[model samples]
Target: MDNLTHSLVGALLGQAGLKRKTGLAMPTLIIAANIPDIDAIAVLLGGDEHLALRRGITHGPIAMVLLPLLLWGIMLWYDRWQTKRGARPEKRLPVDAKWLLMLAYIGCLSHPLFDWFNSYGIRLLEPFSSQWFYGDTIFIIDIWLWCALIAGVWLSLRGERRGQPSWRVPAITSMAAIILYIFANGLITGRAEQLTGRAVQSQFGIVPAMVVANPVPVQFWKREMLWRDSNHYGQGVFSAPDQVVLDPKIGQHEMSNTFALAELSKDKNAKAFLFWSRMPVLREELREESKVRILSDQRFGNPLVQDRFRVVVPTEQDAK
Candidate 1:
């Protein structure tokens, strides 16, 4: 999810019990919550790739617990500063370090958690691990969630007269959107699974070892699906899903030789390799001397989001 989305979600959730009583100041909470992500600015300043470090050190367990404690201390320190300057004191900070820390963890951690759900991955366990956790959920930016959140924000901001009903509009609206997305994705996942299952059965005459389904957004009426062999750490699909062998020329996919079994149909010797039930294809790394040529997805290497993976062909002598 985008930074805006993260801020909005935290703001809306914090607004639930924070309508008036020196509330979490959902707006301020939004800032304090996202402040931990300031490390991202380092990427813009220098061309260094640091997503692994940023997501690792900043979103790790230590920062998750310490963030709220720091914010609560700042709140108390600021009040004393204002009082000393003879300025009228505003409301006392209602939330304690414990509560603030919990809120901060929830808000700050939301970034990596939500990012993981999208095709993009997240480094939830950093320092010891640079492994990215990816979830094949709804796209990072979903239309319905945005519209609902914006509307909720608008509705929550309306001015009310004395004795008028106070609407926690933002909280309610966001909750509704979250609920809808959960079920909507369930249906989407099912449709993707069904499509891939048919393709696998057509080629192999048996269910595929596993299918990873990714929803491609073409437009409102038309939808595109990507099917990858199930590469997962879990039992079901949606783990580390691979790529769909979409014929770049034509978008149509069939259960027969036209596309699904096209390679097998062409190479009689390679027929056994076509079925997902058989051994998965081990991709070859094209090497030049010591250099390798391959797409990032094809390479058996890990690069941070910022670093570009170089492709080089091996030299003649290097092959020997």
Candidate 2:
């Protein structure tokens, strides 16, 4: 999901079965987990943010199947050279080179598997297919899950006994908490939508065109409710999210066509940059030149963000 999150997971995996000086495994898993994102290179060097490139070759099953073996081979060669020179490799991996290959495979594949829980999904099947697969679980980085892992690592390290600690307990506990949190958030979001809907009906005396609810920090929420009335707009933050009015400045008819509306409504791109993009506050501008540009609202601090992904309109009005 993010670097820190990946590091935490790597640490957890690193500690699982390695012997002396195994801390290297933590970084190994961390870097391995992120190897799939090397497609970012395709972004920087190519300057063409094509979906096939970003979500295709790298995230596909082929990468997970092939890259780890390559990494292990490179590592093996480096280790053989160091040993011949009578030098020890720093953070030496303890397992036999061949066995380590297997571990590398597991570590590398786990990342894409876990990432599928998010709505963004992944192109795991790759060259076989480009379809995105999603599991609709986990917030990607739930604090509760982080806490469980951290707490376990801390308690085990402090050692009520020897250098060994009971990491198993914490890992199991954390996994359970992660699952529970995902399910809970799913339910909570639905309830929030209903509450928001009733609140809108009670206040505006009309049902909104749409209601989208999502969790925020501190057990609170932020929502976006679209009103059907022309030139009318609805916006709010809970618990007063129900009250909305016709904001003539951004009316219903001003909303773009079906494709534009779908892009905004399911602004998964915005959701991808949760910290920097506020989907609800984002504004879509249809240039008179017939191009679509989704702009961020400065009020939410989205203006300072640098990453912006371009998506095709599915159809073009004219040939380029």
Give me the candidate number with maximum lDDT.
2
lDDT tens digits, residue span 188-299, model 1: 6666566556755564444544444443332212123433334311112222133223322211122222432443333322332232111122222544326322212211
lDDT string for model 2 (1-320, tens) is 54455555655555444322332344456667777777766555332233335555787878887888777777667667777897866656554765567657766776786676544357778789866665433445556556766765555445423654564555445556656766665565566567766766777776766554533333423333333333344544443334333223333344435554555444444333222222223344556556654433212322332234333332233223
Q: In order, how many clashes per candidate?
A: 6, 1
> Scored by CA lDDT, what does every candidate get?
0.48, 0.52
TM-scores for candidates 1 onward, in order: 0.63, 0.60
Worst 10 residues of 1 by lDDT: 232-241
- The stretch of ten residues in a row with the least summed lDDT in candidate 2 is 297-306
Model 2 lDDT on a 0 to 1 scale: 0.52
After TM-score superposition, what is the CA distance of residue 216 in candidate 2 from its true location, in Å?
4.6
